[model samples]
Target: MVGTAADADELLRHVDERLPDVVVTDIRMPPDFTDEGLRAALQIRASHPTTGIMVLSQHVQRRYAVELIADNPSGVGYLLKQRIADVSTFCADLVRVADGGTVLDPEVVALMITRADRDHASGRRLTPRQQQVLALMAEGRSNAAIAERLSITEKAVVQHVSHIYDHLTLPPSTDDHRRVLAVLHHLSR
Candidate 1:
């Protein structure tokens, strides 16, 4: 694998040249250490839609998650540095992103879900159970996982998800990440 500690400019250059299938970068990088990597990630995604990006940060930044996920949820991930402690899961998540799957840090998902449930008008329309389902969905949980967590049947999870889509006015989509984007859209508004 090609590796470098370069700034966004160099990173972009490499991406342009290599067109690697996956990129794992820290949110903060050289020359400013602010959001250079995040900016580069956005540019890389815009320029190379097929590329996968995983942004790792020391802390949870809601805005970072919002911007990266707002436009598209596929082939992207936002994880905290602590996640690497579970190397197997972290590596699996990276592969999942490279394979066109969305992987969100649980903390980031909680932040968005809480904001949506507590403040968003659309969230106000949802029942408490529906809100719970939405939170799991935002975490990139499948219907089966949500069901196991909530101690409900998968069929019930499906029904709750349907209600969430109806309340959010999101048309049904086959894409797995659609629910995540929908949740973020509600939070953003």
Candidate 2:
């Protein structure tokens, strides 16, 4: 909440003046109102790698979501405006993004899962439970968070994540973030 702007240009100027830990912007802004905000966000991400970005939009726009996280999924989020109804959760999501975690709206995760299910060309199918775990993973949930949400043990969540990696044919990585990125990349395909 360091600064606010009416349009993308002003937003960029404000960012230049004083970079904030996280930036929450709409997908559309003044002057054409057609992805100007997203463009500005991409510019900011390019210039300020440490700054987190969250795009709150009314529309689904899967392509836009994919583009935002294409190069770097860390510290990025794409959430629907409807998510603001839960103020605490929304605020938590902002904090997570600021701390270099990727967060996608539940609706976005649902759409991605639906699309992935529809296009079953990957040859490896995930179990229903695996799908649920993957959805939470895409939402940037840690193992403990996923376990709590699923009413399971953290070790069980870890097992599901490992199975997901095996099913998706992702190479084993010591970095948890890389595992999330690999899963996200698979879903986006």
Candidate 3:
């Protein structure tokens, strides 16, 4: 079923009635035009356990991504509004979220990686090459993609990822969004 709300309160009210399988909302909506949608999304996540959330924004706001995926990365997705232009890909992402998968826009991931590289708590400890691999990982790239981007072998990419997890002190997580969360956790510091 599909429903619409003008503001965060209305959205919550709608959710209170019956949770939808997925929610696709813009980051800036209603009342304040600031983070109302993001705040509301978080509330929904806290209140409704089964619903999936996909937040869209014109700009890549790292904080939104971090907060949404902070506790549980599953059933969550954050994408730039432009992604909607490619209807097939956008719908596929939403479907992935509904299926308890996590999807993050590459731009958002890149932004987080860039910010983390500058001031993340453990970023300084990462070798520049490791940092690049982490950034590509944050972008949801496969080991193959990382290797192709860096002109390194897939085995090397795997090694870099292991080191990134080690340097960040991330206890191994099977969560699909672990890579993105690693970047988010760094930026959160």
Best TM-score among the predictions, by candidate number: 2
**Residue 81, candidate 2: alpha-carbon lDDT:** 98
lDDT tens digits, residue span 65-143, model 1: 8888778878899999999899999999889889977888988877876777687688888888997888777666789
Backbone Cα, N, C clashes tallied per candidate: 0, 0, 0
Residue 68 error for model 1, in Å? Answer: 0.4
Off by over 4 Å in 3: 140-154, 171-181
Candidate number achieving the greatest lDDT relative to the actual structure: 2
Candidate 3 lDDT at 23 equals 90
Q: Cα lDDT for residue 144, model 2?
A: 93
Order of the predicted models by lDDT, top scorer first: 2, 1, 3
Residue 35, model 1, lDDT: 97
Question: What value does the lDDT take at residue 175 in candidate 1?
Answer: 65
lDDT per residue for candidate 3 within 1-189, as digits (tens), equals: 668998988888898886899998888988889999999999999999689999999998887898887788778989998889999988888898898777888887767767776875588888989878876765556799789999999999988888887887777767654566666666555
* Cα misplacement distance, residue 121 of candidate 2 (Å): 2.9
- Pairs of colliding residues, candidate 1: none
Q: What is the lDDT of residue 72 in candidate 2?
A: 85
Name the TM-score of candidate 3.
0.81
Candidate 3, residue 48: Cα displacement in angstroms equals: 0.9
lDDT score of residue 145 within candidate 2: 89
Question: Native-vs-model 1 lDDT?
Answer: 0.85
